[model samples]
Target: MRVMVALIATSATYLVMQVLRDEPEIALEMGGTYEDMLLQSTAHFSPLIPGHIWFRVPKTDARLRFIDTQYGFITPAARFFTVSFNDNVITNIRMSPQIEPLLLDDVLKVVLDLQDQWRANGWTVMYPRDNPPFADTPEWRAKLRDVNKGGITFWQAGDKYQVFLDMGRFRDSKRPNEERYLITLALAKPWLPTQVE
Candidate 1:
């Protein structure tokens, strides 16, 4: 009888753990809207010194470029990211890590982890090769030419948000050892249709 009760208690505990594990750690803020969270996060030119910031998109033209104030130049081998907004709505986000002698696999792992996080937050993810957006376009073709060397692309499709991840070298001047992974996320207002009617 005691054994049975203990077994049941353990089973209940396991079930509770599984349920909690499935829950998302970071809940969407700003009335639970993706656009709101994005806008808030990209509003300021917050330095990468400590914690990150989240806020609504800003009005007018704004750009955040990290520079070494003491050295009077841009930081070397540091991650760089830019966000662009259209009419106070998020249009683009680009993130690029510093190029160094790091292992390609290690760099890719970091990007993949980010992809997984976005996926967990309910973003539909796809590999570009599997679902090419502009496969026939000359520009896409040119970009694909160098995709053999660890270049990859991911596209997220949805009316609420669209994201693109272009990893590896797609530029002519980029060296083989340089890591130029870029992640771009765009969000269109719910009232506005992305497709022209």
Candidate 2:
């Protein structure tokens, strides 16, 4: 009887693991892909293949925390869910389909001019191998190794919200140049006015 009970417990545990493995990381589109009026470009580290991403679960009530969402050691540019190894304040990085990369820098400069930009939002630039709690991690230092090569770097200075600039080996698949820009605005806070709310 004890042997049968043990076997049942083991089988239940295995089945539960399989089901949890399929849970979405970073919510539906927050991972990076964004949809806009003109164009619909996927965000960085998206289109992740199943079985590549994993979320840490502490208890039944704990929220799903995607691999990238939590700071840890991981590989760069992996096709897995956490492949991009992104660590930034603006978690999601979706852009409209009609957007163009030509004026990316120009637009970024203008947004940076905002004084309260960083206060309203936060962003930290990172490479594919970044290990963060912040931008000053070893992963960020690694980017300097090939400064000339260029890579994706997140920026919140551009606007009140965080933005990411693609300046690296590869460009976004949906967007043309690797110079694609990303902006992830936070949902309105409880106190913030909604157009005179």
Candidate 3:
């Protein structure tokens, strides 16, 4: 039985190496760093883990961010994940921009984990810092103050990591209020090839 298991494992390893040699890589022009790829993509949730099936981890760190909105950044090698809350909505833990939709009533363990990590790292986590839900500028407040209507985007601009939160009524609704929040963080892609620190 031991020999049989070893044989299976060896054959599987060989098969994966063979496939990787033949697979086409995702190559984005402009040399986009990790943050750029995640910001522009609306791909489904893909948790980073062993023997997992989801979005492929990029070959370079430029395809991931060191920090995202208040959700914080998932270490390239970290396996655990948390929920995202915006206006009482739970964002996807398996992929990006794909909200669980029904899990808004559930507690956001992911957000809390992120908050804990941030506090451990000494970052000030707060909301309503930049743009209001319905307006782009700091001076304009949305007439409709409902918190639950919005979208989220992320990126790394210059020396800071940024999360762009946009809020509005769901499609076909009659509401004049909209909201947006852009959060900036102090972080960067780790230069080490195998380290997420």
Candidate 4:
């Protein structure tokens, strides 16, 4: 009985590891179906509302967490990681970090990292005329806020798809008076607008 139990435990551990393998880089690619998302990540997604589903990155020590959401030492950087679907096809992916008062430097880094990933997958920066070496100053932040009303930056792949990075105001439902800022990254098809709301 002891030997049989040990064998079963080993098999279960291996199965869980195989299921939780890191595949978020490809998983976030646009135009996949819900089943494709499930097959790729094998992470459990909770329904945020009617059309949206949310998931967090699983911790390294925890078998239940997905591999994409982990930060340093079990901290989850992504707080609101949601996927929106329209008619069973994934329309967009949205994610915000757990930290509040999103800093301009950190937000720019995230956007640049995302841009790097998109470039690997055949996308290119199409706007702003210049690439980063972005100055993170009080004046620069204020200028960004002033010029881009929606606080959004985007890249395009041919005429096919677009990726948007938004650093926008977010209000907590539980704390109505407190306003927080967050960076949200979204991937969408041409028909869907990545609106900041």
Among these predictions, the greatest TM-score belongs to 4
24-84 in candidate 2: lDDT tens per residue?
2233223432222002211222332234333221111111121222221111111122212
Best by lDDT: 4
List model 4 lDDT by residue over 54-167, tens digit each.
333322122112122211011124655666777666666555634445444666565556555555655555455432222457654675555244365666655656656666
Instruction: Tell me the alpha-carbon RMSD of every candidate.
Output: 13.2, 20.3, 15.9, 10.6
Name model 3 segments beyond 4 Å from true: 1-72, 75-99, 105-107, 126-159, 165-197
Q: lDDT of each model, Cα atoms only?
A: 0.40, 0.31, 0.32, 0.51
lDDT of 2 at 158: 23
Q: What is the lDDT of residue 76 in candidate 4?
A: 25
Candidate 3, 76: how far from true, in Å? 12
Model 1: how far residue 57 lies from native, Å: 13
Q: What is the TM-score (0 to 1) of candidate 3?
A: 0.26
Instruction: Evaluate residue 99 in candidate 4 and report its C-alpha lDDT on the 0 to 100 scale.
Output: 44
